[model samples]
Target: MIEILSPSEITRARATGALVGRILQTMRERTQVGTNLLEIDEWTKDMILEAGAKSCYVDYAPSFGDGPFGHWICTSVNDAVLHGMPRDQVLADGDLLTLDLAVILDGIASDAAISFVVGQERDPEDTALIETTRRALAAGIEAAGPDARLGDVSHAIGQVLSVAGYPINMDFGGHGIGTTMHQDPHVANDGRPGRGLRLRPGMLLALEPWIMVDTDELVTDPEDGWTLRSVTGARTAHIEHTIAITADGAEIMTLAPGASS
Candidate 1:
């Protein structure tokens, strides 16, 4: 189902967005070589409860997943790209990490994600992957606004990733988000512009651009049945933000306090 939030609902969504952003930022700051993925989940749980917000992942049973995501945040490390269930693995230096989060506050929900390297080690390939997703996300946001075609956002995002030499993965992409973490009007990473659903004011969308280094195919972890990894074992990155379409343009509601999107 597609949802267009009311003015007051959008106001509440901003608070939810801020909370999601702050959690991701906090996790990034606290993470290091020795940090465990499960620890990140714990930190997220604490913050969500403190804010009186509900986590969109925990107890989330979806067909694509094993059922009951059972975690506060998604920890996609290295080749793992999406739906990564937190576990006991300790991160190493140069590990590419992606943290995806969604939360509901004041009956409104927003979602966002960030990808970064662990410790002091940095790989040029990893940096490019991370930056490309960020750029793609920005392109998606720029293409969204009142009366804009939904495919325009998809096309813009696709152009960036495609030019960067990364194959687009169609299994999962951005989607409409409001009271729930995931909604209809599925936004593909690549599509033709001037097509698909026409965007409207008050629409909320979580635009996430993710890619694998060498392949577009994804393989689920056998043990956990959740973490989605690259078929070729290549590194991956994902960047996301919750945006609200307005009269003028898109407002990035999930940006951290005093932070730029």
Candidate 2:
């Protein structure tokens, strides 16, 4: 569904977005070599419940994934990209980890993701992948504004990732997010400008740009029936943020309170 949030709803959305941002930030700060993915999930669950908010993912039963995600967040490792279910695995040095989160606070939902290296071992390729996704996400946000076509945002993201020599995957991309997570106005990572849905005030969008180092193909891991891995086993990175269109332009709601954009 395409939802144009009311003023009050938008206010609530900001709260939810802040919570999501803080949780992700906390997770990033606490994560290090030897940290377990399941531990991160547990921490996420505790934080959401403590804040009196609901997890958009726990009971999520989308067709693309197995019924009922039953997890608090997505933990994509080096080769994994999307829908990465938290497991018993422990993070190691040089591991590229992506944490994707969405939560509902006061009936409004906000979503965001961040990719970073696990420990002190920073591989140049891994750093580049994460930086590329971050740059692409910035480009997408820059292209978003009232009356701007969704394609423009997608094109901007594609231009950044493509120029960085990464392959884009169209199957899973950004989308409209509001009262519930994953709404309409599907925003692909790459598309032609001047096409697709037009932006409007009060519209919330999750603009994510993710890419594989070598190929666009993905393989679903049967172990959890949720994790999406690169076909060539290449490393991947994803960056996302929930944005709200306003009279002036787009405001990044998922940025942590007091954090610079």
Candidate 3:
């Protein structure tokens, strides 16, 4: 369903968005080589409970995933792109990590994700992949505004990833988000700018741009039943942010406290 949050609801959404951002930021900072993915999930759980916020995941059972996610955050590492269920694997230097999170605070929910390299080792290819997704997310946000066509956001994201020579995967993309996590008006990574739903004030969207290095195909890890990895085993990246359409333009509610726009 497409949900246009009321002004007061939007206010609560900001708080939810801020909590999501801060949790992600803290988790990223605390992560290091030898840090287990499960530990991240635990950390997220503690923070959410401490803040009296509800996890959008953890008990989430969707058709695409195994029943009950049972995790506070999604830890997608290296070739793993989306819906990565936290496991026992320890992080290694230069590992490309993506942390996706969503939570409800005061009955409002917001979602966001960030991809970064863990430890001191930096691979140029990994850096490029992360940068591409980040730029694509920015482009998508820039295309969103009152009265803007939803496809414009998709086009903007696709243009950036295409020019960077990455294959786009549309199986799972951005979507409307409000009181609950996922909502209507599915936002694909690529589409015709003039088509699809028109933007409206008070509408909230989670704009995520993700890509695989060599192929668009995805193969789910059989063991976890949630981790989506590249078919070619190439590295991948994802970046996302929850934004609110306003009278003037878009307001990115999920940015971390000290994060630069």
Best by lDDT: 2
lDDT of 3 by residue, 64-86 (tens): 99789989999999999999999
lDDT per residue for candidate 2 within 99-206, as digits (tens), equals 999999998999999999998998899989989899999999999999999999999999999999998889889999998898999999999999989999999999
Superposed by TM-score, candidate 3 places the C-alpha of residue 255 at a distance from the truth, in angstroms, of: 0.6
The superposed Cα distance between candidate 2 and the true structure at residue 84, in angstroms, equals 0.7
| Candidate 3 clashing pairs, residues 3+ apart or interchain | none
Q: What TM-score does candidate 1 reach?
A: 0.99
Q: In candidate 3, how many Å is residue 38 off? A: 1.1
Indicate the residue-level lDDT of 184 in model 3.
94
For model 1, residues 31-90, the per-residue Cα lDDT tens digits are 999999999999999999999999898889989888788899999999999999999999
**How big is the positional error of residue 192 in model 2, measured in Å on the Cα after superposition?**
0.9
Cand. 2 TM to true fold? 0.98
Model 1: lDDT of residue 52: 99
The C-alpha stretches of model 1 lying farther than 4 A from their native spots are: none
TM-score of each: 0.99, 0.98, 0.99
RMSD of 3: 0.7
Model 2 residue 100 distance off true place after TM-score fit, in angstroms: 0.4
Residue 91 lDDT, candidate 3, scale 0-100: 98
Runs in model 3 deviating more than 4 A are none
